[model samples]
Target chain A: MSEIATPVQPQRAQRYGLRNYLQMYAVAARQAVIEQLQYPAANMMFMVHILIEPVIYLVVWSSVANSQGGAIGGYTAAEFAGYYIIWTLVRQFNLAIGPQGFHWRIKEGRLAAELLRPVHPLLPDLGYYLGYKIPQTIYWLPMGILLWLLFKPEINPVAWQIAAFPVVLMLAFFVRFFFMWLLGLVCFWTERVDALFELYFAAELLFSGRLVPLEVMPVWAQNVANFLPFQWTFYFPIEVLLGRLDLPEFWPGVLAQLAWIAGGYTLVRLIWKLAVKRFTAVGS
Target chain B: MLRPLKLFGLFARISILNEVQYRANFFMQVLQSSLSLGTGLIVLNVVYSYTDNLGGWSQAELLAVYGVFVLMSGLIGSLVLPNMWAFMEDVREGRLDFTLTKPEDSQVLISVRVVAIWRLVDVLLGIVVLGVAIGRMGLEASWWLAFAFAATLIMGMILLYCVLLLASILSFWFVRVWELMEMMQSIFQAGRWPVGIYPDWLRLGLTYLIPVAFAVTVPAEALTGRLTPELLAGTFVFTLVALFVTRRLWMFGLRNYSGASA
Candidate 1:
């Protein structure tokens, strides 16, 4: 009697890992850059549009400050310059492509592939999202330098404040993403999402200090902005950078951000569940 | 000219019929326009929260300016822009060839191909707002001022059409000029505020380079009893130049349309 030798079986390929995710991000960034570079004139036009807003706001606020005896609500012309420059940077960072991609995914039935992935559906989406920002960062550099040169902004900050900037900004990004994604998910219920987008934009302009600084708003409006999560998304980080908020104020803002992030995450989870349920039930 | 006018009338009627079929869109448009108007008013409220006047204009006066802006934008959105902008896309896609082959003046056909019927709501809403603002300002609307407003509004329409046509014509050379259009729009949006508030260079650009000031400022000045004869003359001259350049450019673009060597 001879024992038979058993053949060895091969293992299945491992699912995507951190390196794969990094590669996805890199690919997304490269794709974004290529897409942008393909339309040099268009990119230039967008840059000009972006440059115009800050300039308009800066002049408007500067004029306001000037008329009010060289200051309004503690913002002098130079201080206004600092605030707007920082505002511009914060805005550049907080910009997103909205839920258009999600809509596309649903329309094309590509969302199922994302759902099938072992990682969270948002990870790859976030990668693609962050990838688009790479070109934007490059585009913003020259403008930033030009703004600094023109405005000569007095944005002196403590070292700790500088260190905390990126953290606050990342939290701001998540808050915006979750909130907008939740808005996008509403499309599963209704085919049109444009009205919702406009509503969100209008609210954001007022609450996030996009049009004007929260400090300059009426005290009640400022307090309302404090309660809302939008300030955490834009104004808070810029405020931190501008040294308007001290350590005491900074910690509370961070805490508020954490609360908002938790709340946003919960809302997104609930909305995505209901959206997916509605989507599947409708058989799209 | 009569034939084109009749054709345009038919196109407008058909468009109105098409829009009526989509009753939801009409409601949505009203909602959107109201929201947009509300945003403008809110911004004004915020601005006035801190100060009574912005750039020598009171809140009511600024509202008058906004009314002019909205009214002009509505007209552009309704008539001149719809067809002109679509013509650009048609040219890019070689669809303009169909219009060119028609036994009609191509320019007239292209300029009145489609109408945005719902945009009349914006025009009506804007006029109502303007009437209210004018009443609030307590300004006398004299016959001469009304005439000035009429003339300047005509000049503004011509200037804006020229600009849109020029932008569309540029599509012959550059297929992707929509970004240029968007950039122009953003600049025009800034014109919701008076040009005086902007820096010197921007004011010059708005007044002369882009001529956005003609869209709102002249009519606003008319309503405010501040329209001068020189400004009206300047507007007329600007309109004449814009129309001439636009016509020449349209001819040039048409010649190049079929990849013809000229």
Candidate 2:
């Protein structure tokens, strides 16, 4: 039977065209949806865990606002609610599973297979990530509705701002993904990528405006956050969604996001080259 | 008991030898623990910037809470969780049969099977932090408070072990208990703060429903000289109850396993 069976031909080496990428993304998305559906309870619990962070922060800030006579640092209770609710969406969209992927690929010696792929290995990563978000949004939608009911978020964005939001959010995802992917490459050099991941999380907590608003942080921290790309990933889009950033501030934020995406892409490319060299030299 | 202690000592020695093979892991553990400590300190500093007190507790009190939290987590990671995490895998692969056939209490053997060894760094760091926090608060430690703290800490470890054992035993029934464990861990993160900080309903849930309060807050209260007679009594009762319930559950799970196979 083994001798009689003919080996299947390799699939065509398609060029990285827009249509090809879209089909790949669609297939990846379907796979993610199926995998998530297979473990519905686990996915539901994951969604609950995701919502818990935003709820905790919202409660913390709400308490702060209440203590400060229903407003703190120019944010009323309603506005704070809006800020955190939008923050949940932005965070869900921007969070990357890059470190785990990198660690697994490197440890399992599957990075070699990735290097052998005709297309950019990162493309499949991007596709799988984007695909996962489809099911995540399905999970998030009801939670979003629940938050809206409880918090009554006053998220009144202008039509144009609403249109521009997804584009900027996509840019933000790339920024986060590339930076984290670079951090993940550190596993090639050291056995301990966890320390790097921890620092990344710390920076995200402090600078990404997840714990508190950037304006509420100390001015020095705010200034540092302004220079980093972390804020653009979470805080900027959230601000835009909450209509806190007027048109002038909003466009510049988008420009800054674009700049960061370009920079992050360049950095990831350079890191990937170096990481491959180290990986090959070490024969992992 | 003495034999089990000797077995644990042998396990510790083996784990240490295994860890020594990965010399870089020591640095990783140190770096990870330091960063965790730093994050805790930073959060405390940030909260203090807003007010001297958090939820009616002083900054030093909150630090003590974190100290107990870290210490308990280290204990779990060092002994309970490392084994419980593997317990399911052992059950799935029938490797637990080997443990069952051993000339010892299977529960005792299974509970301390895999010591992470490096997690002792967190334990030591937690002790140093707890000491500093106690000194900073200028609280005088009495014999009763020390005794209460020691007892509660031990009970906290036992309670945590029981909870983990119960959670892992569920794996014998359900193959995918990992996500449930993750959810439990996420819920436990809320316990890092004082239960008082949460809304009243949440406080009730943490205290009775999840029992995370007993794991961290009871010991913290002892250290902060805030342990009431009622709270101490409750901790003791809960510890016994949790241990008894988990012991029964483990045997039930084992019987189920055998019944299904037969």
C-alpha lDDT of residue B181 in model 2: 77
TM-score of 2: 0.91
lDDT by residue for model 2 (A35-141), tens? 87788778887877777777666766666677667777778768888988887788778867668778888676676666666666777777777777777787788
Measured against the true two-chain complex, the DockQ scores of the candidates, in the order shown, are 0.53, 0.54
Say what the interface RMSD of candidate 2 is. Answer: 1.6
CA lDDT scores, all candidates in order: 0.79, 0.79
**Each model's backbone clash number:** 0, 0
lDDT, residue A17, candidate 2:
79
- Pairs that collide in candidate 2 are none
Docking class of 1: medium
**Residue B107 miss distance in model 2 (angstroms):** 2.0
